[model samples]
Target: MANIEQRGENSYRFTVYLPKDAKGRYPKERMTYTVEGKYTPKQLQEHLDHEYLKFKAEVLSGNYVRPEAMTFSTFIKEWDKKYASKLAKTTHGNHVRKLDLHILPEIGHMEMSQINEFILMKLLDGLQRKDGQDGELSFHSKRDVYRTLKSIFKYAVKWKVLSQNPMDGVEKPKAKDTEEEYQDLQVYDEDEIAQLMEIIQNELPHWRAMFTLALAAGMRRGELLGLQWNDIDFDNNQITIHTTIVLTKGGPHIKRTKTRSSKRTVTLPLSMMEELRTYQKHHKNTREDSGERWIETEYDWVFCQFNGEHMYPSSPSNRWAKMLQKHNFRYIRLHDLRHTSASLLIAQGIHAKIISERLGHSDISVTMNTYGHAFKSADRAAAEKMESIFLKK
Candidate 1:
């Protein structure tokens, strides 16, 4: 039985009575509300009645929704639908991948109400252990997973879906600063770079121009593929990065650059300028050969497939991986090309602010943070030079 008692002129208290057991233990399952003064007694009564009926229906149907049942998988789908439009495609894709690969498989079906600190700690412990695929998960990956879970729970609390986040008190695993290992970025020294360029020009003529552009221009893989003839200024020897090719639900599409700062202009080096001029001559001839078959969009991308179709993001990365494997080069990620460019610039004593602008980073902080170790090395060299000057005096 449920009853509503008027506490004041603008207040009403509602209570639901649970059946008592033989031991006279009654469950205190009740909800209270204080109606606004604007509502008449009849209107207030109607609203209260509706709420009571809804609660009764839920009780009868045995469909009580508990917070514990809100698994990561279920909540993420809801979150995506509600917030996907506001998120960048890459970010949304990453969120979905993290949930699927880390959160869902571990605790997808568990009741959200049942998840407590103890359960989460155990789960983290399991993740740290090396039993699963790819041996044990790295500290970096584990930290990311933990952070993702924490964010989800925080959102759940804000939405009133849960009273508190279970991850609130959980401590994250300590991660070593791996910056030292990459202090001196593993890039081809001048001799090695010369050898690589020679091989590409002589042996792999087809991919020679693209490899040269990547090393010289420092354009990101996706950004390189997104390059169009229209974006290049032959007279000025500069290239504007306004868009990038990314994989979306329907397939790959030319999306806006990752950030506003990423859409920038970088002056092409003399060597790269010459290569582009030659490549452009060949590209135009090829387009003319295709004639009517050419699908001309307003943006004339510089790099495309042999058939003049837009290149997929994965193709170049795959090629790079294969090249590295064949040459027995250290397995550096494709993005390392961008790092190599920044490293070379820093090594030449270029200012970080200039590098930041060239790299199209949103701020100098991004440049410093990403290549802080390189900067530290430069600082050490500066100190040594100063000591040598003073000692000579």
Candidate 2:
């Protein structure tokens, strides 16, 4: 069924009929291969016939890797559209960024068969910094890159595009202790929180309400910003966290909470509730002063600009920095407020499960792992209490 056409001197093209289809057609999956060598027409045809027979055998066995199969670039494009489209936007964005910045630049042109553990290790080595070598990517970033690569390969294997994944036993790059330690210290002490609260109360009562809610409810900045008046239950002394204001590339977007657990209701302190009521009244007055200039979004956000437009996602963080500098207080990221709330609750002997619920963590283990150091002191206190009780007995 295959035809070998001689084009010029020492050049010929071979066309072949593939294996049987569901309709029993041999040419259903046709293939064309070029055979150019220093052989005569008869010799070239014989060689092409042998190659065609081998190709047919492999195709029948589902082991055929066509010469015109996907390149890394084409495969990745398909991956993004078909598979990665289901991922969260932020996660998908990170994957695309890593592929563009790290992975694709090196092995993008290679065929699927060309990819192996050795080639992947070489790619990892290219990302790593060694003696007399300067690489901008960190070990943690390289680990992320490796994981992304593994995910891509895993998808390829699932679709039978690749025979096997090369990242099965690949070693991950390790991050330095300094980076880990820095992550551990990303929280503020109770005294620092108290100091910040005192300063904000005296100078900016409106902001005081915001900070108090953040500390008392253990809500993330985005969750706080996304809050609407109706989401708060002053009667029940609770606030429902159903959504968050995520900072997207386009602008601030109101999206569902990161997880199902993040949609739970958290109780607020009576004092914090009073502060919110007062702030609401003041905000209403301010809006009245703005009059026609006040813009209304369908969300009816609790926290917004004077014109009632939704506040930018970064506004809280920006205000946090300036407020700390203005009050001459020690600096902490705005996110540390939530950590501070968890730490204070731990110090007060609150159960880990309770704190985890307040913080809307998907699992109690997540709360324990993140604030494990806070629990160490609580553990010591528990031991001392047990000892005292036994002595009294």
Candidate 3:
């Protein structure tokens, strides 16, 4: 299966001839593998013989694949350059961390053709969030790893490196108790939202405008922080979301919407638009007052700092939490404001599809899944209306 040849006094080369490929195509240029190393005369023959046997075993087992392509690490360079570049910066950054920190270090050296279900499962099972937690990994972290692996294996199949995706054999990861996660979903009910609407009016002009628009438009945190003045259409009372700001260790980063659907236009209530106009006047005065000191960002951010810099991504959440605490209000995470907006629409019997479009959800199923409680309430009201009509007949 192999032979050893002397290249120098202490260096020798071992070449192992690989077997025929799938279609029985028996011989190609890159199918053979050669390893050259300097070895002592006493150990040279035995070392080359062992390496030849090992190489032949890999070829027989269908693990070596096309030797030129070689390891999973080698395939990733191609995937990163060609495919991963298309992914959103936040998503691509996340994938890079999962691959480099976890997956690649473990199996990057293994031939792409050699990866199997057992190997993948073991890697996922061993995953743990290195942050403040016990050894048990969070379901979310493990799920990300599973998603990353599945995408890689799927591409491996498409790129003809592997015959099938090994992830097909692996069960999808799930939370141990999904109900516990659902129970943690805190949203302000209609009454609480109403009270906040009134309270924010008296609090401050800047915060009032921000909080009102958040509840009205149901924009994500980053989307709100990244909102630019040009994105607004005063004539139509609408705003487009095509860019987002994500805080990074280096600083804030402007990224495109994660998916096509995430780039959307949301129609605001007329009253909210009116309030925004008023805020714009106030903002202009503030900017002029800071004339010499005002900083400018790439976009004319609608929710800029007093000095006209882009608002920090986490600023709203932290400030919201403090405001709730100070006022002794029932607390919910800032994200739950989005859920509160959806709930208000559901209460008014807005169609789920319309709500999904307004919220810029990638799929209607995501809207249904996250706000099933609101859907249930809407459904109950529909049933009662049907009952009243039938009873009257």
Candidate 4:
């Protein structure tokens, strides 16, 4: 039972009785209503009644909204206008692409409020089942689409445009477990590292310094691309990571580091410092020759394209793939370099906290979770040492 009682001057209290079990133990649920601006008590009651009815309807329908003749495409466009500026450029671009390629063509004609949880689930199921000429949806592409939908519903709730997020209760399609197959960290052994260095120096001379920096410093691809001459302190053998370069729909853009803690300084090895010094000399000469034509933004980036434009993160992957093929080595993702650095550091007995900071992880927990295998290996090594000491004695 619910009632509206007059409190003082245009103010009223709305109370609802929550039913209890045989034991008379029930949770309390109530609301207070205060009306302003010359609304009569009857008018306020009517408005509240209408809102209550709409909320009740939403609950009865499992939070389903009947499509209001607005197409998914139109809604997405509006959503972008309202929310894109709040997102990173790369993230915004990705959301746009996902809607255009996956969601819009399939269900853009449907009404905005009409998409129920079942229909949304079916759509995702269809996407998971889809196969291009090459075969089924790539793992990365599938995950991207799922994430996009999740974000869209999240935004709907945030903007109060939807009473409830329909996709919230829907289960996402199960993607292949590729993480174990594609190890997050792929550090080369001493021999492989030596071979890689030799190959980069001999064949991909332009990439030698980049590879060295990645392996030695564990910088993210964007952070590495965003580096500037000023960011490097040769005297101190340190590099200050501040920002990241990302590819957006409007082409490349610079953004703050992914997390606040990602903006940190990493001490470079002496060998890497020497390499950077040599690269700096060449980079300065290149910049001077290019003059005003160079794509030197306000932030003087360290690595630039042949024409002096900022290097794209994708460029490294392409280069790495070609180099891997040329050298008859297994191709690894560019991010694997960071993992390689972490693994190598752990193997050398560097503390986990130091590794976490060097890799720009927000917390040591992240490092531990991702690279806990390294700690287990360390434990084994410690046990072996202890056994040796005791057994020999």
Candidate 5:
């Protein structure tokens, strides 16, 4: 038997009766569910009715189990080994970390079948509240946690553990203003770049060539570190980027570029190429002096330690930060150099398509979306120039 009772605004209780006991006498206790949301009265009744029908069908089919029968904590641990194992190492690590740190502490004890849309909404809203370990998380972080839960529920559906995914009704959070603020703070200007370059030339002679290549080609930090002497074409003045250095928990690992577009051939400026050649000569002399002490890999990396070992992926960023600090320059992360390259190109009337290719973005839309503000500024400047040329007295 199913009966729906209103329990204030946007809330209702669904009372479901169980089968008779051994002596054909009904049990005193029944299941009552309190559902809450933004639903109107009619919508709330409709939802309760639907859930009642589904529960009756499951019971009639001999498949109904009480909500308290299965816990989420038990299922998620099993899900990790079987499903999470199929994911990439880094991705799998992220999933486990989130599950352990943020998710499990909140909902792990609840049964999967008992978790409804209302519960999911409350959990997400709680995450947005400024009461967690690091205060209120960003929309993106909350969204990621939501996504992980969604994926877990999807798995539950696939395994026939639940008939519906509660997250299907939840709205994913939108981009907040902090994203724009962070992106704008992640780049440098022409004057700052010139000053940094001069300091790099004077003080950090060994890393000067790599830093120059970073600003000039917009190559990623990993790509720059993975470069080998053979990847460079001195005659053609182009460098092929097919590999990258990735740092994981274990150690530094050599892997392919982030995406297909990331594995590109970028033409080097003549002066930059000459500087690289000069650096190559100096590196060769140093290697010869080191003799048997040089630990050479198969590729003979262009950038490495004094003993010719692979450089850690984080070293470049750390070194760049230290150099700026020592010279009393404005602090910008090493990756900001890539943004600087894009900003400089956008300011010089270069087409977005060409800049996208130079930056090795998988899609031009990514490049456009990232640099839209810069493009807007450039567009305004272009319009002013046209007015000066044709409308001036």
Candidate 6:
């Protein structure tokens, strides 16, 4: 049994005791946890109960590490073994890679308790992008490190491994070039979109259907690559996005979506659905003609090689580049097709929330951040509409 005490309005302390050995060789005190937060009385009680059970279990299970002796590296190993499995496979790999490349090298040796906001801030101050020669990191790299560290120390504190989370004291890095990135964004305007549509029509059935879906649904490239046949709803004319393809040195592998929100059902145009049916018929003929050469899997990949194995995740981008060059069309990243879809929707005065959902963004703010210019263009049109109502002309 552990003793629980209320130290303040919402602060609680839990003290755990270890049983004494017959030879009086074992220490009696195992650990003490103290945390302060805003919680209702009922919530506070639940928090205290959870803290006690977790603390008692750790001591009894011999899993408790004395706060004084615990290193960031040690905690990371424990965390990775226990909690990293919950993350998507690619995300887990990326987190581990970043920790090894940047974070672990700086603070892995230090005691978790000894690291402060200053140490963490200094560590962040030294981060740099892989391609850059500058001393400071880009907002992208900074955000990755910031989120990684914040998640790590938050878990440490939650599990009672540390008394406080120093990350709480650190300011999150902000992207300074939000407007610049928006200005520099690539999107096919209405005319270019029409031109693209016309050009892709002459392509092979599979390539035509794949790129058409990209422009129609705003799916990420990985989402398109990982899409399986069964994910499509023929009756509703929709496709469910739940998995993504990740490429590694070994080969391409399938992984679950990055966030819960990334798994969504997007309704697509009826005409495009007919295009898919045509492609499906084409695929059926290919599978029969290929005979033993066709490698069939349970996945039934919508887009694949002639042998039926899924193409390399980058294959679409590579082939898309060639197709554009062959057609003498101005080139944009295949991913910009997603932006093109959003830009076209905004041009039609589609609501931001609808665009966010269509893009499978976790929040509308993400849509706003990426497509601020599109919204500004729409807002200008809205102002002109008001002028038509109020002015004589």
TM-scores, one per candidate:
0.78, 0.72, 0.69, 0.71, 0.73, 0.72
* Tens digits of per-residue lDDT for model 5, 73-143: 98887578769767765567667766776788888999887889888888877774434455566665677
Candidate 3 lDDT, tens digit per residue, 1-393? 336666555444445555587878665222222334676757866776786677667666766546335698988876888687677667777888888778898999988768889998888888765666657566667778888888887877765567788999998777678554455456787778788887787756777888888889998889888888889899999999998898754567888877888999999999999999999999888888998788795568888887788888888888888888888898888888888888889989999999998888999999998888778878999999999999998
- TM for candidate 6 is 0.72
State the displacement of the C-alpha of residue 375, model 4, in Å, after optimal TM-score superposition: 4.0
Q: Encode model 4's per-residue lDDT on 1-393: one tens digit a residue.
A: 455567667555544444575887864433334454665768866887775555445534555333344456666766788776568787888888788778888777876677779888777766743334544555457667888888877865554445688888777665466454234456677788888788778643347788789889898788889888888888899999998988788887888897888999999889899888888888778778888777657667788876676787689778888888987987777778888888888888899999999999999999987788777888899889899999987
Residue-by-residue lDDT tens digits, candidate 6, 38-75: 77879977887888888788878887778778999999
Worst 10 residues of 2 by lDDT: 28-37
Report lDDT (Cα) of residue 247, candidate 3. Answer: 73
lDDT of 4: 0.75
Clashing pairs in 1: 67-113, 68-111, 68-112, 68-113, 69-111, 69-112, 228-301, 229-300
Superposition error at 338 for model 5 (Å)? 1.1
**CA RMSD of each candidate after superposition:** 5.9, 11.5, 11.1, 10.0, 10.7, 6.4
lDDT of 1 by residue, 1-393 (tens): 437777666555556555786889975444444454466768877988887777556544665444455565667666778664358777667666667676788788876776788888777766743345555566656777787777778877755567788998789955456654354345665566776766566434336677777777777877888888888888998989888888765578788897788999999888888888887888888888887787755657788865577788788888878887777766666677678788888888999998998898999998997788888888898889999999998
Candidate 4 at residue 252, lDDT?
Answer: 77
lDDT per model vs. reference: 0.73, 0.78, 0.79, 0.75, 0.79, 0.84
Q: Identify the runs in model 5 with alpha carbons over 4 angstroms from their true place.
A: 1-74, 96-110, 114-150, 178-185
Q: How does model 2 score by TM-score?
A: 0.72
Worst window of 10 by summed lDDT in candidate 1 = 28-37
The deviation in Å at residue 289 for candidate 4 is: 5.1
Candidate No. with top TM-score: 1
Q: Can you tell me which runs of candidate 4 are displaced by over 4 Å? A: 1-67, 112-114, 119-144, 158-162, 171-187, 203-205, 287-299, 377-393
Give the clash count for each candidate: 8, 0, 0, 5, 0, 0
